[model samples]
Target: MTVFLCDGECEYSYDDLLRHLNQDNYFPLLKTHHLFSYFGNLVKALTNDVPLVLLDSDLSPAELDGVDESLVNQSIPLSVKRLPSMGEVIEALVHSTSEITMFTSGTTGQPKKVVHSIQTLTRSVRRGEKYNNQIWAYAYNPTHMAGLQVFFQAFENLNTLINVFNRTRSEIFNLIKKHSITHISATPTFYRLLLPYERAYSSVIRLTLGGEKSDGHLYNVIRQIFPSAQINNVYASTEAGSLFAAKGENFQIPASIHDMFQVVDDELLIHRSLLGQSDSFRFDGDYYHSGDLIEWINREEGVFKFKSRKNELINVGGYKVNPGEVENVLNAIKGIRQSLVFGKANSVLGNILCAEVQLEEGVRLSELEIRRILKDSLQDFKIPRRIRFVESFSLTRTGKLKRL
Candidate 1:
């Protein structure tokens, strides 16, 4: 009689999950905000070997190129043997031949489709007795890659998931204490929103940050907030599922798959054999350029630290400025919760660095003050010329800070 999900006032038990799996039909293009229904459809599709496409509830069919608006959320018959228990469903999912189609967050352009198998999606999942009974704070859009990674990891272990994505800082903290949440896996932007740490939540035993680069300052603060937790980073993408786990500040490719990776001119390239099927992916030789620029900590050991995305570096007056590096400095400033740095087209310089900053609640600072703080940390061209204070940040479908 274990509970599967606790979302707001609604609670779903293992029995409820079983009942959903026994349904006569499943939606191939399910779009819903209700996590339970979304998860139910996902499970039903995978368990019954039904292929399905995951769509963000807020995304319009027009935004995606191939999706037919009329066919969305439409149910189709799926006849499969009934599973008496949740364990049976899990077993079926583990051996499923179903293909899952997911789209990119469309931060840079229109959403592109990538189809993945259950193996690639759950490659990093570790299942054992130690993984059981761990309560998770689900903190990403349920349809995205990172979200699906967290879901499969927890679902396979039959662990309880407490929906906390998009929840306010106060509400999240309250839930951590109320549920004694043991694990949290989310993006750096999601963790940044919880800054200006007020108190510790000792119950969080483990934390995993992915989908964005993290810094030592954020890691130090997270350690203080969750002193008992073991924090780590993961590398995942729309083109590839979770691939590397952090070894300190760097990531070391597992020795078994070591030959599958190569660094060419600082860009990490992945062997095509390791990636999901996607038409948008263009390969150079048999490898796909990951766009992630990295510096080797140890070339022999295949250990490296992420520098920044190849496309995210902004050129300002012949100087290349890394927005992530600048934003890390902004985030380290006192009373600043989160910051987004980007380039605005300029008549003179080609592009001028600009920033949007969100301050801690009840705190105020002038843009000049922020500039003065940046003067000490950054080079002249690297500092943002324009800074706008804001109440909140716009997030992508995957809960990352929206960028141009």
Candidate 2:
């Protein structure tokens, strides 16, 4: 009973997906299918290739050329399927080969190839009748980790998925209304951008936020929009598959993994079990130090809040400032819709903090007035020296702010 909507126009059913996957060949680079369809074929491919690479449909020819030659030489479209024995394919997938290569979201830096086994990717995924019969929205790029997570959830629970990638905020809202999408997992930036689009969110039963830090301001707005939906902010990375989830704004370490992580000098560290067996990251004894900084809310109770990435810290004449902290404060303002804070090069102050703000419809506030409000909460160096109004903020493929 699986149903999929592509680009808000085309509709495909479970039988159609099975027919396509049964006919597709594994030797060639498969032409990308609509996000959901792509995952269907990905499951088929896993049983054959020792390592398979998928190129996103949105990538340009030049971008396509940048991928490994080994993958590109054998490319085939999703429509060109080669029939194979299902039992054999499943057996091959489970025991013969397990590695699947995927690219990073490229929010922090250039997108790089990351290899993760199917088992590692699905290690933390939950399955239950509670998730069945739900209509999930696939909002992330299909090739990205978050997108894969959404697909895995639907696949494991036999839930319907609607592809909402490459659509405008207004269009996405319409799709949600049309399909009655019950569950959605996306970055905080995606939710913020979607806030202004007026629509009926009563159909959304669960709303999960990840890929970026969530703040109280964003949480309150989502609460107003999807009043009946259960809202949670999840913490996961490309390197660390689904880690922790918090019901409210602040991320709290769950009891199951409280001893699995430690805060060393405000930076979060993870035990090796949480990470894929990859040599790319440095591990000390059994812990891989996560570069994210945290502020303890209740250290004894395993409650803490994410501050900012260590690299995202701006040094203004030796005074360190976290842009996320400033952005969070700015977002709390009544009329402010979204804000981005970054360091601007300055001769005197090594780097001066600057902010770009997007305001709510018809809302007008002066930079001085904004600063006046910020002054009440933030210290002098932490305040952005320059503030400018903008229509929108640039987002990565996965809908996170493109910081780097």
What tens-digit string does per-residue lDDT give for candidate 2 at 1-404?
45643445677766565565676465334446555456666876765453566566655554443465455546464443253443343345445355676666655555566667777666657777676788988878777778777777776665688877656777788888888889999888878877653545898989998877778888888877787799987787777777777888577787888899987889999998777654456887889888899989888888888888988999999999988989999999988888999998999999999999999889889999999999999999999888989998787767778773
Summing lDDT over every window of 10 consecutive residues in candidate 2, give the lowest-scoring window: 80-89
TM-score per candidate, chains pooled: 0.98, 0.88
Clash pairs of candidate 1? none
User: How far in Å is the alpha carbon of 70 misplaced in model 2?
Assistant: 5.8
Model 1 Cα lDDT, one tens digit per residue, 1-404? 88899999999998898988888989999889999999999999898887989999998867867888888989988896699978888999999999999999888889999999999999999999999999999999999989999999999999999999999999999999999999999998888888888899999999999988888889988888999999999999988899989944789899999999989999999999889998899999999999999999899988999989999999899988889999999989988888999999998898999999999988988999999999999999998989998888888889988887
lDDT of 1: 0.91
Query: How many backbone clashes does every candidate have?
Result: 0, 11
Model 1, 63: alpha-carbon shift in Å? 2.1
Name the weakest run of 10 consecutive residues (lDDT summed) in model 1: 61-70
Candidate 1 segments whose C-alpha is farther than 4 A from its true place: none
